[model samples]
Target: MWLPNKNEKKKSIASIANDFIGDGEAIFCDSSTTCMHLVPYLIKKQNLIIITNGLHIATSLSERSDAKIYICGGHIYNSSGSVLGSSASEFISNFRADIAFISCEGISKNGIYMSNDEQAQIKEKIITQARETILLCDSSKVNKESYYKLCGYNNIDTIITDKKPEKNSFLVNTDIELLYPVE
Candidate 1:
């Protein structure tokens, strides 16, 4: 697994929130640690509602007064601290949002990819159901492929990362907007 360094992960997620989301937009954010870092920014918006599936998000958003949180029911993936399964996929398929912020274990020129099959299916559903999809990842994940393909590069509206893509050859032709942290 290509795990991002702490600062890189935070920068990646913050860039995703700044670029794809607008004021008053309801967004569905995955319960990944990277996604959690972006939650404070989303909560600052008076009209943003966050729909998520993990207990961590619920606890994190509990003290926030500006954002409203909704939990989705599903089986938990203990290793990742995420919810996934058929029921989770169905719930994701039925739910629609202005944007969905997703984080994957890996991604390649071929497509958005994931490490787990059930989580991959849920990610695919989120991509289909949301009007716009923003992928949050770090430099380490770029150009690195995974087993299961969630969707192709065309499916995502934007990709946010901490490192500059110029250093990674494969990121050149994808046509996805790339966001880097401000120095």
Candidate 2:
């Protein structure tokens, strides 16, 4: 399928962040690069609380107003600047949030998967605790697979992408909601 330029897609997807998130709500944000795009949008909301293992997301939002930032304690990875491990998962599972914005390496009929298992554990744990679980991905990622299956398509409440998905039974028969930027 033909796709938009990478920069445009990133901007479109980043803007949708505010639509899924709300003011005064607490959310769990995954450590994916896509999550960083959301921090700017979230900074504008009032009384927003953010919980994550992403060092970048934590520090960037720290100086912002009307928000609380919580970083999961665990072994911090140098490469991605994300903290992960059993300790991280345990820490994340302790608090409940309003929503979780997670980005994965790929997604297929089997499930949404991630590149790292440790980050996947934290995401899955947050999925259980948060009232809403929203998957942030681009159309290029659809029908692809990753190393760890974080959750099945049915598990998430909605998926916000830069483009709308083609008609498929996995999306048609299930309760999953799909969102995209307006033309």
Candidate 3:
């Protein structure tokens, strides 16, 4: 029951993401609100190549002359400002990214999960094209279950969150590196 305040958790996520990202990296970012917090940090990187399905994320970084933004073309979800479908997936396959940043609705011993099947599929494809996949999750979503399984902990190289999971929680049994805001 370690539910965290939304704004506080978002602040934590932003701090942690800033530390993990570096300059001149090719990145894949999913269309999740949590990932949106990464926009300001990404703008600071030099020669950053970002490929994303999040329209809002692309637009936010669009003004950064230091970065290159590529938005995937596919079915658009007006509510989430996300594009996902076969076309988007195919577009993603053309590039090999240094890292993929994704978010999930829930995390459990079984695997990471998403509420939307299309988003889950898109995340799956992103994972395949990146050398490393990082999941951005808040404490509130831990231990919760969702409708579609995106992948297992094995697929994620690291997880950045607002708080570290409980010792007895399923995450402790996995090898994924867990990061949280420190100052």
Candidate 4:
């Protein structure tokens, strides 16, 4: 079997996510490099209501689709170009999305995790408010652990990654639907 490289993997993950999205749907996208890759695919959709904390995601989506980009107001993390804080979490709670696309620093037997506590708080809120939660974690982040645990594997509706995890991977033990590129 052939496996994609880093950049190819990210695009593959983004492509899988695009399959779940459709015209005129509302979605919540977190500020992760994986989610950033999703911007180009989003541009092809019509009347998409994209609510995001990613400064770049919002900017890229705005250039083509003007009306529906909702950027949350909060403290912007310069390193990652993400807006995260109490304000951001509060803002996210106001809208109900058909899906919440998110990524995290790591995933392990315990649960999903984020290095930043603020991001974790917002993600927890995102999981509850959205109809479905799609976690976009690359192969590298799988089987790893981070500081703040976001939620258990059961909390996620589906997981899209560049490759299928090893047979013993904790991800495979869960009931969550796992998706990856077949080629």
Q: Candidate 4 regions off by >4 Å?
A: 1-6
lDDT of each candidate versus the true structure: 0.74, 0.81, 0.86, 0.87
Write down the lDDT that model 4 would get.
0.87
Residue pairs with backbone overlap in model 3? none
Please tell me which model should have the higher TM-score, number 2 or number 3.
3
Candidate 4, 1-183: lDDT as tens digits = 111234887899999999999999999999887888888788898889999988878887888764399989999987677898999989998999999999999988899988889888888888888999999999889878887899998789999999978888888888999999986
Clashing pairs in 2: none
**Model 3 lowest lDDT segment of ten:** 1-10
lDDT of 1 at 48: 72
For residues 1-183, write the lDDT of model 1, one tens digit per residue.
223346755755585566566777778888777887775666567777777765576566766646777767788888556787787777767678999888888877677788778877777877888888888887778777778888888888887887666754666676787676665
**Predicted candidate 2 versus true structure: per-residue lDDT over 1-183, tens digit per residue:** 111234666567878867877788999998777878787788888898889988878877886656888898989877787899999998887889999988888888788888788778888888998999888888788888977888887679988888866666354455687778777
Which regions of candidate 3 fall more than 4 Å away from where they truly are? 1-6
Predicted candidate 3 versus true structure: per-residue lDDT over 1-183, tens digit per residue: 111235768767877877767888899999888888787688778999999999888888886546888999999986788999999999999999999999999988899999899999899999999999999999898888888989988799998889867779877777888888664
Cα misplacement distance, residue 148 of candidate 1 (Å): 1.0
| Clash pairs (backbone) in predicted model 1 | none
Deviation from native of the Cα of residue 69 in model 3, angstroms: 0.8
Clashes of each: 0, 0, 0, 0
